[model samples]
Each structure stands twice: as C-alpha cells, then as structure tokens.
Target: MIDLSSCLSESAIQISDRTSCSKNSNVSCMISPNSTPSTQNTVTCLYRTILSTRKKILITVTWSKNSLSQGLSITIGEDPSISFKVNTNPRLFRKLKGSKSLEFQGCKVEVFWDFSSARYRSVHEPEPDDGYYIFITFDSELGMFLGDKARETLQKQEKSGPRMAKFSLITRHEHFSGNSHYQTRAKFCETGAAHDILIRRSGELEGRKNSELSVSIDKKTVIRVRSLQWNFRGNQTIFLDGLLVDLMWNVHDWFCNPDSGHGVFMFRTRSGRDSRLWMEEKILHKDEKEEFSLMIFAACKNM
Candidate 1:
C-alpha cells in the first residue's frame, strides 16, 4: 500500500494512522489551522499526446471564469520555451470561434476551435458537452480532436491529410465554489465506464454531532469519513472495475475557515499492477506513462 504520509504535504495536512473505512485503506488526518479562503473558479485538463515528430508532449486546455473575466487557454509542450498557445475570451470574440497557425518544435501546427454553438451542462463547467470542436494539427500529418464536432470540422475544412492523434488523458483539475455537495464524473481507464463522482459534507445533522464527509461513485457510497473535524484529511483505497483507486481528501479549510474555505479531493488510478507504489517526490515518474488523476478543489461560502 502507498503511504499517504509522504504523499500529502504536512503544511496542508497531517498524516493519520487511524484505520477507518475498509481494511485496505490508509487514512491521513487534515488540519490546516491557517488556511486562507480561495475564490478561484477554473477547470484544466491535461493530455499526453504524441505529434508527428514521434516525441511525447503534454497539452493543457484551461478555462477560467471570475466575476469580471472569462476565457479559454490552450498550451502545448511542457514549458513555454517551445510551445503553441492560444488565449481567447468569449466576450471579446463574440463568435468564440477562430483558427491560428504556428510552428512548434520545428513542425507546422494549426489550431482550430469553434464554441459559438457549444452547449454546456452548467455555467460552472467550462467544457462543453456538445456542439463544439477544438482541433490541433501537427505538420498536417495528425490531428487531435476535442469535443464532438470532428466530422463537422472535417467536412468544412476538407483537410484529409491529417489523421487522428493518439492521446491519453493525464489529469483533470477543477476549482469550484458555493455549496458542500459537489458532483463530477471520471473514467479510471480508457476502456472503463465513466463513473459519476459525488462528494458531500454534512454538518451537525440530526444524529451527527460533528460534520461528516462521504464520497460516492455511481450512487454507491465507497468511502466515508466521520468526526470530520478530527479527521478532515485522509486517504482510502477502493476497487473499481477490477482496478485499485486511491482516494484522498482534505477539508480542513471547510471547517476551520468557512468564509472562503476550500476543500480538496483526488481520485487516482495507475495502469501498472504495482499501483500500490506511489511517487514520493512527484506525481509522475520519468518512465511511468499511463496514469489517470482527477483533482477537485471545492470551496463553500455558506456551510
């Protein structure tokens, strides 16, 4: 089993040795006494994709929204030293559609995006469910498609040279504020089903003396944390679709500082059988290629 003590930061959370949940679990305690409030609202998705150069690179698509600003950003490669980036705001473009051509790592790259007719499940979600397409072409040899309008984009562009690019989702990071009940979806593997994830916190309910936290997947309660004030930070292991998933949460801010307090939850699964081993220093290893991570940062102003 992976040690949650070395994985979590002591400044943010303390390690708990208490055994809660199931037998295959490691629970760490959380208590950030001076955690400040967070007002960020954004969603970022990182993908591990290969270009025509046969080299691996990472692509980051980010959407950010605040009271006065809302925009989209796409960044290629690991660093800004040699990358292709596009930043656009809906209010400024009105159409929310455009294309840009650039060179990345000595290869010709083209980016096309159309969100004018996109549909969103919620205002908090920056990614659209349908009626949108974001395409990235490398040397006109391969293309990466995001969204559901690949066919529409192909027919309109009439470019038959670039095939589809093979990519793997690395991690999804989201920041949301407002309520205690948060819901999202995650797919542990490429061939696995996308499971509905719900995180809820109950405060001094009818039968409960202190707040409690529960994590559910596909409507099934998988992990529960009791006496949340004392165990605000912890980790658990659960099996899903025959694979082991590491679950971690830190809600110290939610209880200690509610005005702008933020809580964090993470669901991670590895492609290797030794998923029991974790990165002591970093989230990824130099050779460990296939890992899926979902991180949620939720804040509540009222509870």
Candidate 2:
C-alpha cells in the first residue's frame, strides 16, 4: 500500500467536472502484462469477494513469466507465503488444465483453470487474451470467473444453477523491465471507460541536460514534469469519468542509481474515503467497500 496522503495533498489541483478526454477515448486495448526485452514479467490482480459464511476475503491471481517458464499463483488476502501455484510448463505435469482444492480461514475453496487453447496478443505477456477460463468456487457456489470462456465453463460445472459472484477488482500490480517508455491500459473506476496509460522519460535522447516525464491518457498528454531531476517524486490530479484520479510517481532511483534501481507509480481514484486510509495494512484485510487502484514498478535499463 502507498501513503498517498502527502503526495496528493501537496500537489492537488482543481479541475472542473466538465473536463473531457480525447475524442478517441472509444478505443481500448487488452489489459495484458507488461512487456520487456529480457526480464521476468509479472501481474497480480486483487479481488474482494464474499463467501457463503458472509466473510469477506481478498483473492489475488498472479501470472508470471521468465526465461525459464510460465507460472500462475493464487493467494488469499495479503499473504504471499501461503499460496497455491501452478507451473504451466512442467515436464512431469504435461496437462494444461486442472483443478485444486484448498482451505482458507476454515472455508473450503476450489480453483479451476484451463490454458490448452489460450491465446495471447504478444508472446511476452503472462496472461492470455482469450480461449481460457479460471473459476473459483466456495461452498459449491461460484465466487469468481475470469477469461473469455465463462459460458462454456459454467455449462461444464456440476452445479445445476450458478449464482453471480459479488466481487470487484480492488487493485492491480505489475512489474516490467525495459526503457523509459511504458504502456498499459486501465479503468480508473469500475463503471468508467478503460483508457491507454503511457509513461515516458526522455532527456539524453533529446540532447538536454535535465530529463522530463510525461503521462498520456487515450493518446492525450495529461501530466508533464519539465524538470524530473529536481522533482523525481511528485503527484498530480486529473479528472476522468467524473472521478478524481490521484497520480503519484517516485523515480528517485532512476536518477540516483541508473544501474539497478526501480521506479514506483500509483494511480488511485478518490471515492468515499481517502485511498491512504483504506490502503492501510490493517484496513486492507477488514471488510470494506470496493476501491480501485493501479500500481506499476518499472525497472529502467537504458533511460
């Protein structure tokens, strides 16, 4: 979790609700894993769901890929040490589809996945584009469904009737290693539109003494940092889909140590309560309403 209170309050700006994005906002892309020439790619999606016991639990699905193989891991609420993982490319486990039974906080949970025919937009992406399904069940009820083959998966289940899952995506975390230019897609709010998010840093390429940072949404630049060396850590506010998005970045490592330093960027929406309060370590596990946030960790090799 990020302590965005200081960042958002220090550089908050006032913007009218009438502000609109680019006319090409209609265009959208798949929320795939980050891309890099040579590095491990990993993406984790967190969801808040309710069990039959009325207990709220957080489920995290992490997809990862490296030079060796591809992997998938599922963990319950905040603890990564205890998890159920699947290696998609194991010599002993040649099968591409399977099911697992696990217990969490005394509640029984079942996870099902199939990736034999999974498709991908790019070879470097960890998650698939289509032709797959990942489902979670609690007390014989569907708790969550992912992928494009939902209808087909439900038909094959043993349950006669399936009920909808009361779940929402709370946050997403991604890691990538490459140049300063980073691209991904996101939906600021649950009911809002998904826009293209691009972050770029350039100074050496332009023959300038100081580097600059720019953020673009839907092909339109929304935030720019003219002197990145002086202001390597900062925040800005932007309006999207009638919501206020607080964006913060810390690229201190990129300037201080260019060899093996990573940058952290965060984009969170302001709703009923401050994101800082809800993101506290204690509050994250407690029962709470839905909130969306995106966190990016970029490792710049040749900035």
How do all models score by TM-score? 0.76, 0.82
Q: For residue 158, what is the lDDT in candidate 1? A: 73
What lDDT does model 2 reach? 0.71
lDDT of 1 by residue, 53-87 (tens): 56776778887776666667777776655443444
Q: How close is candidate 2 to the true structure, as a TM-score?
A: 0.82
> Who wins the TM-score comparison?
2
> Which parts of model 2 have CA positions greater than 4 angstroms off?
1-8, 22-40, 78-81, 89-93, 151-160, 205-208, 272-290
Model 1 local distance difference test score = 0.67
**lDDT score, candidate 1, position 293:** 78
Lowest-sum lDDT 10-residue window in model 2: 22-31
- lDDT of each structure? 0.67, 0.71
